[model samples]
Target chain A: MRRTRPPSPTSAGPATREGRRTWGTRTAAPTAGIATFEAGGWRLEAVGYSLRPAAHTEPPMKTRAVLSAIGPDRPGLVAKITDFLLARGGNVEDSRMAVLGGDFAVILLFSVDSAGFETIMRDRERLAAETDLALVLRRTEARAPQDEARLLWQVKAVALDHPGIVHRLSEALAQRGINIVEFESHVAPAPVSGTPVFSMEAAISVPASVRAADLRAALARIGDEECVDIDVRPDA
Target chain B: MRRTRPPSPTSAGPATREGRRTWGTRTAAPTAGIATFEAGGWRLEAVGYSLRPAAHTEPPMKTRAVLSAIGPDRPGLVAKITDFLLARGGNVEDSRMAVLGGDFAVILLFSVDSAGFETIMRDRERLAAETDLALVLRRTEARAPQDEARLLWQVKAVALDHPGIVHRLSEALAQRGINIVEFESHVAPAPVSGTPVFSMEAAISVPASVRAADLRAALARIGDEECVDIDVRPDA
Candidate 1:
């Protein structure tokens, strides 16, 4: 991706404009050097391919695995699973576990030598007989050590709470090949109006060729169509 | 991910074991499937890559980006940045923003049309001039649509507070090729004794070839030496 933005020095338009049938109906900020561009099917690909299991790809290190289980939360659940791992020689490295609404959920990472790796595979059946754990195992690779240059940004929206606001915007973005990394939503009462207010935040990655202006215009289009106010910022 | 832990026909051993030498010393359970294996430099690589920025490769979406900034907490920080994005036609989507201590931090995702993208690139400078934002931008790619078959697991360790607990454990797992996806640590005073206690949890991915038995042995070594109790569970 070019570090510098393409130059288009259009005289800044008035800080305000009207809503229209297009992405940016209102031109609150005048175009300084560049004119508003339309969002479309145009895109560019850098083509860097990396698979997961990345964490353990380095030869000398053994492999890593993720374990998660949700079942009746009880005292023995933790002990039972830990026992199985210890019995099978699985090393506990990291994890997040908790009990919610009477059900315990466990998420953790661990490793074993190649030999134990095979043994543990067979232990699955043994585990079933010994305990009642809904278990899922995933193999993950460690990421390679090369860093690629990329652009990051933050986006947010707020309006009267409504259904599908997230879906509408996200689906629209996804239709244009956008990636949503992190997202959150909340509804709170407006202090004066006492009306419910809905807000959302998301972290996304922009590819090299896509222009931020084009993305902004697209969001504006959605904002206008959906009756929500949208905002974007260069996350520093 | 499997929905349940594998079944093991092996009979249960005594609930208690002795390990004065270090973690799990007593052979409470007999070796059934295999004997204790050594942890070493055995590794394998299966490359399956999915790149971000899959948008251009697929349809009409522009690239997404992640933006983050943390500074003195105050009003208008959000307004200033969002205004910049709107001015440049940047679109807002998903984000995670919050206030902590006396600092306000915001991270969000957004997109732009190709033309708007360029305009916002220039707006970065305008953003800097118009506001006091310690910002960082990143280009991100959309993940390919493919279901990766994997083995996921969980790992945990707890004991009296110590400086190198996380380091020693992580380094050891790294050598074994374990990839830790998530990690959390905390120090709390024991209820009765008021002694400081350290605990950690992590999610990890294990390669298909790695053995859980071998991994456990490695953890046993660390736990013994580091004086920490550790546990592992199959995550469903």
Candidate 2:
């Protein structure tokens, strides 16, 4: 999440008020179902859970599936979903789940062998009915070993909010044989004038055959034609 | 797509032969069905699509739902999905549909009145079977009116990749009555030594009653305790 600043100090959130310290100082008490570390009695709370230690097992096949769901934001949603996946021998490798507005939206990628993945597929309807989760799963091939040749670069562009910025820019990169790894764009009002500004940042791959200069030149052309400012820098 | 540089330049890709410029110089040809503007023959390709002009109608309550599916990437996947939604009087508001790996992944939010939404819910099972697309429909509340008192800020933190980073930090924010509006985190290699680094960026809302300094202090403590580096910035 990236943002500029508010105009006034009050707009940044009311000045620190010493009198209104609302949080309870429940000293030395561990919240239910939560573990706390009492290091040196500093009242420092760990406030979290840790995974149980795992026993030795053969490294499993690296099959993957992309899973996504959206449901009313309610307690136990994550547990309900993760529990089902665990019970089915699917292990979540990575996930990006958030409450977009009031709805609980999630997109997860889990590892599961072919048979186990098919089992999840067959039960998709049942899972939806039972968990009250609107779910979709895509079986994916095992992750490939890392490619050691692609150079990475970061690019940022800003301009008046307009349609086609993403499509045009992405198309331009594609034409240059550059692959966009991560890209995010947002529009926010300009601080003083309140004009909406569209800004984008992308992590891209530059093939060794494609000079960074060539990619930068192409982006510059797109920027000139589209009336946006763009910058590309090597990833740190 | 976020990759380190490949080992061999030849293996990276075909050498940049100065000649293979593929995007057409089709001076002003409308690209098939997509709308195009032929202004002064500058070939300024009007870079996008616009909604079809609409006839006057009563302002409808914008009921929304998220629909997602994954199937072997094939032709007409979007058309098939959108046709179904359009047939049901639903208008696609926003969507993130892409071909990830070999499968087509789509997540869409569409608008319809409550009754029309219910019709789609009841038809969810049928939709899945008919289109061979695992479809899920979730009803979401209309967007809440903006709260002027909610101050926005961004927080970024990085540490060694560990299991509880997200849970612990999120719990801390929730305890302070903060709302995380947007968050994305990833575990990537540290450039120099290649140690895995867990980095998070969150856009949060602090009520007018909460002081930004206090919030920052608490986050700083979390960072110290968790061995992370954190930065928070306000958004205007």
Candidate 3:
């Protein structure tokens, strides 16, 4: 539920009375001339005190790219990868790199405007050839404004540790015309017994026709059939 | 904005039909002997059959703990930390450990039961005291539950990357009586210019009285005062 309103500048009462200002009025006055008005309460002595809105400047468009690299873990791996992007007209946006099972994997989201990206992607093929690393590149489109109506259901499943659990559940959701916006899965040892346990967290969008209760029931059924425990709840 | 609905299972055609079958409903009725039925197009004959509703049993409650560690970057850190959990009556649920700017930082969500948690929490202090590591314990009650609201608003600030951005924004939300369910923030390289950028993703609950527009306006003001760019949108 509803929690009590905390102390804030916008909240009513004494808090609002202390040097408070309206949103528009905060920026309306020139930053340099604010001291004069502060001396006298709301008295304007100057005539040309007109406020001009700041110029609207849109950020430059940049190319979006996805890159993946796999190789033996080594020192300066990230530095070398970043240097590659810097050599081109590219900038790394988001990246998740890890060394799992003795193999290094790197997934990067980057953007660039320089035309040299094509050449870099072609040249980096040699890294894979020489160092036993694999690299792939794909241009990505700008992410559209995400529609909120679809991101409603949050699903979690727990079961005995096993492979292909993620694939099965994801395939089931896809079959039901659901889209997963975010997902995380892991296998952890049981706290007391030391048995391995698998758990997954997924944020999904369900069609209006698919009632939440029905989806939960169906997931529960699937969990039972697969010997797991599933919890589906709305994700704000 | 309502979109067109995809086709349903029944609407797809007869191939998607689902039919229920009962035991002993088919074949020559046991002439005072055994009964038989066909399930999944397979012949099933039995002297007796029982039907039961599928139910999933909850796993035994496990004691959960959270650990924090910070140290100089080194190899085998994960193995050592995980081996510690394994040795104790604990399991690592989820963890985000990284080496940023030559310093390794780890935040792990883990669990242990009534078996040997006390000893682990006690012994873990030695690790923190002896090394640059820092460990903390968080029980299950300290963990926030997944919010059940469907709409999520993600607020991000980007300008010159600086500290205290998260603290200020979180304090603002806390002051406004908003509940933050989940949050993540990082300093990212700029997408186009290679400049430093600060980004934050917060899943928050907006009460009915507090419109999204108002929240955005408030955040925009904060961004202006702090010389940062703020983007507030639903977390689809």
Candidate 4:
């Protein structure tokens, strides 16, 4: 039998108030049949059973929060947001942040226990007032994990600058029941002439029944209709 | 029959003493079977055909060159490099540049025809001397279109501050023939007491036949051995 040690008391609590509620409970003992090891400088453990109870089998958390902060771009955007989460007892598990058009835009996904979640939501006005910024919060459900064995395709489009290119292309994919797993867009000056150019790349999951050729044809048609060049290639 | 446009007239000119070349051509009438569109201010065209042998596939042209300059960090790095490339009829295509540890590093991929390519290389010594920086130049080969799809996976490892965490984890992935697409790492100060912590996020490609679970397990084992925490998630 493998011996499991309790979580280190020194471990910092979750940064979000909700996270504190969800993960704050003490375990009676490390569950049996699990393994634990220490390698790089962290405590490593694997729970053989699901972390959440089967009866509760609540869906995975998928909520999107849009964070907008306008001020002099400084070195502490990350530090400030992190400090906020820590103060609220929340942990930011996933996030994308960047400076765009002179403003810092942050989109983050996080989870918290139901306890105190409402209170934090109500304090949005306070956060904005104190930080001199605006914040919008929305609840999002977690997406179902795609089958690991399914074939995936990459679609890329480039054209003279235009807006809503992503929206139109994504709508086409949605009509085909293709699930977009990832997407990114940028406007860059052309290498040779300095002409403004826009490019978008997307990774889409394709079910077994979908034919690559057919998908390509569909994209080609859409490209023609939209006057944008599109290419569909097999994603490794 | 499709009217194939002859190769660019300027592109095929004789190489100079310095081994530079130039090519200039105009687009031909659009093929009836092909599709073309404008997106994000750039024109994109797609033509489909079965692979076929050409009586003469032009020998790879050394039209492009990569110029790198390294020195103390400062502004004007972009301006200097751009001036050089533009003066010699070259154009910047794609680049990843950053300043690390107070040292400025610039890597640029750019293109030019043979005529002007030699002039650029011949002036390489003068460039280094004038800029007060080390300079390296390499003739570039024609780029084959990339048809393979790329998937990005974000992997993070947090362990006790150590020297070889990256090396150990990267070596395991290399042993499995995995290719790392991009990576960023930082040493974060622990929240409560400011204990040093090491964390790395790498974008990697997963080849067919390599299960995500298997990779996760391998990383878990490494984490256990090193006493670190590891998480592998899709970059969506």
Highest-TM-score candidate: 2
**Clashing pairs in model 3, backbone N/Cα/C closer than 3 A:** A236-B149, B63-B112, B64-B111
Worst lDDT window (10 residues) for model 3 chain A? A36-45
What number of clashing residue pairs does each candidate have, in the order they appear? Answer: 137, 8, 3, 48
Candidate 4's TM-score on the B chain: 0.63
The sequence of per-residue lDDT tens digits that candidate 4 reaches over residues A1-236 is: 01122234324323222232123343334557544333223233344322323233443332323232332222334445545544553444444343332233344434444443554577767766655444545444443454545677888888765434444565556555665554455557788988667676766767766677778887887688767888889887
DockQ of each: 0.03, 0.09, 0.03, 0.02
Q: Kindly list the per-residue Cα lDDT of model 1 for residues B1-236, writing each as its tens digit.
A: 00111122122322212211111112322335322211121111111111122122322346555465544444345556666665555555544444332334455555655566677775676676665545655544553432444466788888886445665766666565555544455555789988767788776656656687887888888899989999976667
Q: At residue A62, what lDDT does model 1 achieve?
A: 58
How big is the positional error of residue B75 in model 3, measured in Å on the Cα after superposition? Answer: 38
Q: Residue-wise lDDT of candidate 2 within A1-236, one digit each (tens)? A: 11111121122211223221222122344467443322122222324322221235333454668887877654345555666666676654445555543676666556666677788888888768865767767777643544547788898988876545565666666666666555445556789988767776766766677887777788898899989999988998
Tens digits of lDDT, candidate 4, B37-129: 322223233343222223355433436555544544333444455566667766555443433333334444455668668888888787666
TM-score for candidate 2, please give it: 0.51
What TM-score is obtained for chain B in each of the predicted models?
0.51, 0.59, 0.61, 0.63
Q: How far is candidate 2 from the true structure (C-alpha RMSD, Å)?
A: 17.7
Superposition TM-score, candidate 3 onto the true structure: 0.40
Can you tell me which runs of candidate 3 are displaced by over 4 Å?
A1-60, A126-131, A143-148, B1-236
**Looking at candidate 4, what is the lDDT of residue B124?**
75
Off by over 4 Å in 2: A1-65, A71-133, A138-148, A211-214, B1-142, B146-149, B171-177, B191-194, B207-236
Ranking by DockQ: 2, 1, 3, 4
For candidate 3, give the DockQ.
0.03
Rank order (by lDDT, best first): 2, 3, 1, 4
